[model samples]
Target: MLYQSFSGDAEVGTSIFTMNGGSLTAAIGPLFYITNTDSIIELKDADLTAMSGTLLTASADRWGNNGSNGGVVTLKAENETLDGSITCDSISSVTVMLQNSTVLEGSMNAENTAGSMA
Candidate 1:
């Protein structure tokens, strides 16, 4: 299933939509109001559940400066059954490893925080 919209309006089949010299490439579905001054979108392995709106700009890549939002960025699984919770800009670092691993259950609102485990 590519996309089955209830009302949000995205159902793209025979998927090859590209706009070079300005940059846009979509295969699957669901992209609305991508008001691009400079844009890049890539999805390799995806089964992402949900995300609601309100991001009024400033999301530069190269692993730097990930801030400004109205809350909701989620990546559910990485390297098998990874659980979640990551709230940046308030400053947070959480890393969980194998064999019955859990971290930062609740109430860690950071001004400056650091954590390490192996």
Candidate 2:
């Protein structure tokens, strides 16, 4: 993937990664390093009955596409907890919905956007 980044430096791509449970051992580097526009990332809290220690963690930064055009991120957490970070460049969009008294740790950084967790 590193080689592709140096090809043109004009096009920004999108990749999706999802996890349902358990651990991901021996992982190197950031799982999601988004720096593109028109990307979609959805992190919803599913399976609330089990109630494990920690469910998910994420980090993304989409700021390379068109200088300030980031992708879209939809996070829906219901009856669970989520941690990590999400960052968007200028003119990006993100919708975060926490239901059933859910908890979201870590941070979400979005420029020129408004959101509330209640």
Candidate 3:
């Protein structure tokens, strides 16, 4: 998939890279990345779990048919679930730009926190 940034800010940067895509049955680990500015990203469900046996996976997709809107994809329920724990490590800081449809009504654990929207 393609991950595009909607924000036009100068200090903003977005990335859509597939770290791993093989088999969820194999051993898995935490997925980590870095952000320097404010932005919104989305991941779609495109048979990404087919080869990996992942009932729940992270894939970027177009938001509301608006590629520039900058929204996030929701992974509520699916075929496969996350295999293990999630760890986030950051050196400086990060910002979370949440849109109206993007909801995180659950618990989250992280390190080196920064910005958020409610």
Candidate 4:
């Protein structure tokens, strides 16, 4: 499957996107964009290869716009392979956890934030 642009605003306790057990290719745009507090994108047990794009969190105007606090963006994956670039903005709380034989074959760029990759 090929995705051109993936962006949305999800409510709390809800996920914006989720993928499991397949091959996904993203074109020349953002793979995922989280624009609300506690929004999540769960990619578990899948093979995703991105050419050139980002998994950005929040827009410039909406940065830190989640109730005066950074929104929560979670990327949880297990046994997956990701290729290309992913970015998390400064005003968002992003968590990325890849475990159990997962491989990342490109750049993961986070701006003014920290996340776990294990």
Candidate 5:
């Protein structure tokens, strides 16, 4: 049970986070709060659960900075289990891919604007 947060406060326009063979339960979150235009989260042979709110969230800043807000996010789960929902802003997009016995126990939302695709 590790307590941590992965924020998209990097200089790169694209933020990618990958993990394999483990269990990740949100201490408190959307688990992933990303503001990058291109955000990718990949989990293989792992477990991700969210007890409240959402599992992954994509949009503008957590702050009031809506300058470069909204983009596309790709979530890849292979031979894993996911237990939560996903949220994509009205101007953003969220794409989910499940493969090889991957299980999704929740819903997802994708806004899919002109600049983005779900």
Candidate 6:
């Protein structure tokens, strides 16, 4: 699907946000805040351009009751640009496809023990 303007936190709880051959443009608040353990956010063959807020994963305290499992953000898209940051703080993981080209204008912090961006 194509999203013109996306605002607020999209708390994905054990669910998937699949951008299939489309684009999602963030115009206001943070695009996503993964709060559920083992939740996935998949961007497949798509594009995401952030005009405003960041795309952030949750912390241990925010990860529901089962914070040990952590969450994953899979970027399978061809291209992506973040005007804001993409943060995964010690309780989340992000996998970016080798073929994808991603640009971050702000800052990205993947500093948790379990958090990784690769």
Position 106, candidate 2: lDDT: 51
| Best prediction by lDDT | 5
| TM agreement with the true structure for every prediction | 0.17, 0.44, 0.26, 0.63, 0.75, 0.55
- What TM-score quantifies how close candidate 5 is to the native fold? 0.75
- The order of the candidates by TM-score, greatest first, is 5, 4, 6, 2, 3, 1
RMSD of candidates 1 onward, in order: 15.1, 7.3, 11.5, 5.6, 5.0, 7.0
Candidate topping TM-score: 5
Model 2 alpha-carbon miss at residue 109, Å: 2.6
Q: How much RMSD separates candidate 3 from the native structure?
A: 11.5
Tens digits of per-residue lDDT, candidate 6, 18-88, equal 66667677676566655434445656455666555575544444323554645566644345554566666
Candidate 4, 23-117: lDDT as tens digits: 77667666655543465566877766555555444433344444444445667778877665555555545567777887666566534343322
* Candidate order (lDDT): 5, 4, 6, 2, 3, 1
In model 6, what lDDT does residue 63 have? Answer: 28
Overall lDDT per candidate, in order of appearance: 0.24, 0.41, 0.29, 0.55, 0.67, 0.53
Alpha-carbon lDDT of model 1 = 0.24
Clashing pairs in 1: none
Over 24-113, each residue of candidate 1 has an lDDT whose tens digit, in order, gives 223333121121012222232333221222111112222223332111122112222211222222222222232223222222223233
What is the model-wide C-alpha lDDT for candidate 3?
A: 0.29
Candidate 2 RMSD computed on C-alpha atoms after optimal superposition onto the true structure: 7.3
